[model samples]
Target: MNETFKPGPEAVEIVERESCFRGFYRLDRLRLRHRLFAGGMGPQISRELFVRHDAVCVLPYDPQRDAVVLIEQFRVGAMDKAANPWLLELVAGLIDTDEEPEQVAHREAEEEAGLQLGALWPITGYFPSPGGSDEFVHLYIGRCDSQGAGGVHGLAEEGEDIRVHVWPLEDALQAVKDGRINNAASIIALQWLALNRAEVRGLWV
Candidate 1:
């Protein structure tokens, strides 16, 4: 903890909140005021935030082959900004009320990639876009056999059409560097593995 970092929930005062929309997802408008760093309270501000469920994202890694599993799927939100809206990403799913984060990781691994995970390593968690969204992502590195781990798999009823890919660790990192892997969760997970590969391999192998 740094001494200069002192921001907390206590610093914010919520004056009012209203539900703006509710569907598969949610949106809320909040009227609030926050304590200023230099002196006193700041002016009231109104902001609409995207309310989302916390999700678990796992990078299925095979230490034996030094490879990783990635999934490709269509993203409507990125349709405008991305060269291709169908982007490569990690296996992920929202945490259900009856399940834990690790459970969701394992289930999503099987659902999205058709692979079973072993020896899960908790990496880190973060908010993808705190400015307008309250979506938090729990990241992990799940050990698995990447041999012959490429194919198309997803639950059709859920409107999911996914393509699974197994890439060598070097090539995957290169994808990250070349900006091919653009999603936040996948990028963070891969970069974390890049920084701590040896430690993770030592622990799993």
Candidate 2:
């Protein structure tokens, strides 16, 4: 794969920007223009972007038990489209302060699953929905003991009612295959583990 076409941030032009909403989550309407593929400036396009702080999601894996820890919680956004609004997801939290992504990952692991992570392996980072949202997610696979992982744990002040579940690696992958695990970060982390489990286990050992 030898290619030489790269466009940087300098290629985009921000003409105007205005705040659309300023609540828990923010929405910004932007008027911008970018260089077209044919080598010219495109027309100014106006779009609303959902702005959110960066977040971290960790797939807590217990290699000794060959199991993974997951959390179940209610999601309002999926209420209309999903059969059940309560979803099985990886331990995740937003970077609300000056804490680093690794710190958020560890903190969320304790808060959501009541487990302490061991070795942490960075999987990848991505924008869940770049077309409309600027929510960047840093994903990781964290080592943990799943024996005592299941329970109802969450911060009451945050309105979180989370149930922890420990699933065998095979079962988790099956859920991913059958659409049971539909969250983007969870799906990506599970699939990545499925492909790299041997290497990860070796490293952990």
Candidate 3:
């Protein structure tokens, strides 16, 4: 490891923060200044931040069959980015207040794909967009019995319209290569599985 010094949260100064908008989610404007690499603090600047509950994404992998479960749903953010707004993604949901990420992972898998997960393997946690959002995502690979995992599933109360697909693990990885699996959480989970498939299977055993 490099012996370079790294700054921590104490390095940044928050001059002011206020809510700009709040509805289903929130937008906040912040005036902040941070320590510069050379020596002193940089000039204060304002930036808009998107604030939301942290999220959990679980990729259901069946070591027995070497398959993975995925879901398709419409994402408003992709309206202008992709030809089709519907994206193939992993099972995911925001962590409700007081809800643990493990619980969200299990609940989302069941709600979005009609699959039950057992023995989850933590993949990673990250900020999907650190520059604009404080939203952090926890990623996991859950072991499942994909004997007959397929079809449409999701809660009607939340207006969720999800279609489930069970594919050979290789095919799912191919989707990432082909740009079909475009979401950050899904891509990260799938790539992690690809690199550690055998190791994950060993853990299940």
Candidate 4:
């Protein structure tokens, strides 16, 4: 793919940032020291209130049969916008301060999808919503046996009622067109798989 957006000519520095709260998650109020721009001149950019987080999403692929595993859960964020708040999504979770992103992907797969992930392959690392939230998601694709994947398993303490769904590559691709798989991470994962299906499937056997 051709490059869409290149980096700006320059960036400003953050003079200081203070934490408003440091309970479970810390919230910060930032102040920028200087400003700069791209293409000779641009608007003054300010730095403030950037929420930092580490997240992971997995695209579970069955290389032998060319399939994928997905999970369906009720998303509170989408509840207000969607007619059906319950959404079908890829397995994902936040990386704790003590845990690595790959480890988080493995744990979430077992907790949410009841499958073991093999050879964690990093797809990309990016910010899902940079304009408002400082959340960064590390995306991955893990090989698995999709034939026998079953059951609904979720964390009882977290009240997660997630159902696992094993899907062939074609069916999941259709879900994207039908507007069923709506989330950004999930959508990106599927599209990536679609592009690289043949190579991915050749790995297991």
Q: Rate the local accuracy (lDDT) of all candidates.
A: 0.91, 0.93, 0.90, 0.82
Q: For residues 1-205, what per-residue lDDT tens digits would candidate 3 score against the true structure?
A: 2234358898899999999999979999999998777767889999999999999999999998889988999999999989999999989999867889999999888989998899888899999899999999999999999988888899999999999888999999898999988889888898888889888888785
- Per-residue error for 118 in candidate 1, Å, reads 0.3
- Candidate 4 stretches with Cα past 4 Å from truth are 1-10, 21-23, 38-50
Off by over 4 Å in 2: 1-6
lDDT of 4: 0.82
Compare candidates 1 and 2 on lDDT and give the better one: 2
- C-alpha lDDT (0 to 100) for residue 17 of candidate 2: 96
Candidate 4 lDDT, tens digit per residue, 84-148?
98898889998766999989999999999999999877888888877656889999998888878
Provide the TM-score for each candidate, comma-separated. Answer: 0.95, 0.96, 0.95, 0.84
lDDT of 1 by residue, 1-205 (tens): 3345368998899999999999978999999998777757789999999999999999999998889999999999999998899999999999757899999999999999999999899998898899999999999999999887878999999999999999989999999999999988888889999999999888877
lDDT of 3 at 179: 94
**Candidate 3: C-alpha lDDT:** 0.90
lDDT of 2 by residue, 1-205 (tens): 2134347898899999999899989999999998776677789999999999999999999998889999999999999999999999999999989999999999999999999998789999999999999999999999998886788999999999999999999999999989999999999999999999999888776
Q: Which one wins on lDDT?
A: 2
How far in Å is the alpha carbon of 22 misplaced in model 3? 1.2
Candidate 3, run of 10 with poorest lDDT: 1-10
